[model samples]
Target: MNNISWRGIRAFLYVAEHGGFTAAAEVSGFSKANLSQLVTELEAALSVQLLYRTTRQLRLTEIGQGYYERCKIAMQQLDSAAEWASQSTDELRGEIRMNAVGGPVGEEVLAPLIIEFQRQHPGIRVDLDFSSIHVDLIASHYDLVMRMGELPDSTLIARRLHSVTTRYVASPEFVAENHEIAGPDDLKSLPLIRGSVDTWTLSKGKTRKTVHVAEGIKVTSGRVMRQAALAGLGVTRLADVYVQADLQQGRLTEVLPAWSEETQLTLVCPPLRHQLHRVRVLMEWLKAHFAERYQQALAEGPGQHFKSNLGAS
Candidate 1:
């Protein structure tokens, strides 16, 4: 019956099998009154008396004995199913769909992390999508997504992985041929590779400048933009993480060191997905990986310009 509860069934079975309410209460840690009431509720719901109770003894009726046997088998199966589900949660097994910004950061950084994660958790399969355009995580059925800049969707749960200090960079050859870029205004004089945004914003101390850079080649892909810069195409703005080696190895030159911008890399997921074991594990693993990396960098020296904001959500 609709009003019958599994708890009440369990209670009735305990009293029936143990042969007395007092014995069932002692074995199950349920008080005698509570056990009696539960069995009574079960009987009322079924419209059948299940127990013949007296001061000295409690016994199941003929119909009650038959019902008890059926309930016992069903309860055992239900218990096994519940245990299987609980054990499955302990096992890392599922596919996680993710969307990420396509660039060196995804290729050189995130790709390796995913690979290592797969190696550690061989059961978990990851479906990673790399793109320059922003896609809705919930609508796209993505289990997780990596985003740059501030997230506008307040409905999603997000954690700060790190912030990348951006730089205006050009290939060493391009820098040599072009006029000197002493300030933001000087950037307008040279050829510029436009990225996602048409305008570039830079800040120095308290002064902020927004310049509509002369577009030489416009592309949305950061990987392509980096390639263009590497091939001596033109000046472009890029995250330092993506081009740190290029600057250090003399392949690319930072155009304006004084003026700078930074972008936050956030790990985002739907609130419900964030509660999942696999998704939550991957998220925490990434956060820990970055936190350890940047902390180690900080330990190395003062010149390293990496900041981890793992504390912020």
Candidate 2:
């Protein structure tokens, strides 16, 4: 309607997307009452009952669903037009929305990199969302997404930033107290701290096998798994990027090195055409960062057991 405001449209879209006024208010920076008022104003202007509300939940009416679909298209077009206009300038400015899996990757790797990127480009604003659930990049308006493990075929433009080798590691004390673990088969008897997965697939050249570990402690966080290993709770398999320092320091000793699995860490964008200059700069920075880290890892060499520490063990 001619009487409808962009604020009202945004409020309605956000509420509908988030499924409630309270959640929408959190993201839109509006008070819940204010958001409710905006939505009411929008409904009054459109002359339709858009939402069916209860004390506990909010549901969209049939007309509301149709309206939401049309509004989403219009909003996407407006966003594209704004992005296009902004791209005319060579100056790095505008917002970039990035999504990544939460935990070690988010806390240890991306958080610092994002802080550094913001410091370098004062004109650019970055929104980093760390969640285990994968969001639809195009529909959610995300500029980029970082993912790990095997990537299925997708229309999204995928770039392999780096491949991190997974290492089965445990504390040197734990390894010393327990009998020597000669190979993957020995892992069956050892206490294992499981993280996110119950099984690990190990490969040696063409030969590959999956070992279902006997779990001692189950954790969702990689950092927690490392901490558990440091405490000598059990063995764990984690990406080298996450445990490089621990390995180098001999806080954790690598077990079954020959069976380590390499998983590719990838960055995916909706499409090259949709990416802005700011997004491109961040992507390049990320690529360079990973490359440098990989080179450093190579230079550092595989983690070694200190002779003095081994003697004490």
Candidate 3:
């Protein structure tokens, strides 16, 4: 308590949240023995039991639980104070842990912007986490997530970065074989390429329909799906950004323009009434970065997905 170490506090906090020393160490970056030692010091200083550790379990002592609550509040306040001071300056600096879809923009557009931002402020650390899954901002502890479309929970702040269109596409060969197709109904007849992994709901207001679009070649990644569609395996739907290059070069055709859908490119933030300045800063950075990428995201997509599958039957 007197010779309080921030490292010890962080480790202790992670341990309290995760319910174990090993987990705390993994998250906060400390060896398990080191974390245990820190906790021992903390407990000795506070003169109170902080945790009850069993062979396979960890539980907070009554005093430890109270201490955790107070510590969490204190940590939030300190984080907020630091974030506010950083934001008040023109320079956006600090470690930003972000979640994003690991696509071309993340590599090409956002990454470069992040580099520039870091160069502008040498003190900041940018940790970008690319994941296909929707990241929980509070629980997973990401500063921001550059996401597409609407947020499930209304409480979240889904800041619109830009809007993008989704189009049904297929290779020239597939189009040649199914040239008779005219509309969304035609999708039922064309060889489809979606995994049964998720329920895709497509609608034009009152005519909402949840399409169970799993058939033909199944794939998990949108990049892979686009590749399959480009290889003439089947007609698949994709965001305009994914197939932009193909659409321009005629490697892929926008088969169902009538069924095309548009959604905003967004950065989702925590639902809290007042989020930390760091999260807010990242959100602003994303909006600015996307403004530059929007033109490309709208006009063209990434290079053709690993093309060798062109001969795919």
Q: Give a tens-digit lDDT track for model 1, residues 174-246.
A: 9889888899988877778887688887898889988897758999776678789999989988777656667
> What TM-score would every model get versus the actual structure?
0.62, 0.72, 0.71
Name the lDDT of candidate 2: 0.80
lDDT of 2 by residue, 1-313 (tens): 5899899999999999999998998898999999899999999999999999999889999999999988986788687767777585678888888888665556545666788899999998999988778676656677888888776748877888877788999999999999988887788888899977889777899987777977588898777888899999988988786677788877889988888887788988766424677887888888878666454543443322223335789
Candidate 3 per-residue lDDT, tens place, 1-313, comes to 5677777777788899988987777777789999999888888777778999899899999988888887876776577566655564554456677777676656655666777777866777878877688676654556667887677777668888777787878888888876567656666656788854445566665665565664577777787898888788988877777887788888888875766788877777654413555557666776777676656554546642223224453
Runs of candidate 3 exceeding 4 Å displacement: 1-14, 17-52, 59-74, 82-92, 152-158, 195-198, 270-282, 297-300, 303-313
How big is the positional error of residue 83 in model 3, measured in Å on the Cα after superposition?
Answer: 4.5
**Per-model C-alpha RMSD:** 17.5, 6.7, 6.4
The TM-score measured for candidate 2 stands at 0.72
What are the lDDT scores of the predictions, listed in order? 0.79, 0.80, 0.72
**By TM-score: ranked, best first:** 2, 3, 1
Number of colliding residue pairs in each model? 0, 0, 3
Candidate 3 residue pairs in clash (backbone atoms < 3 Å): 94-124, 244-301, 245-301
Pairs clashing within candidate 2? none
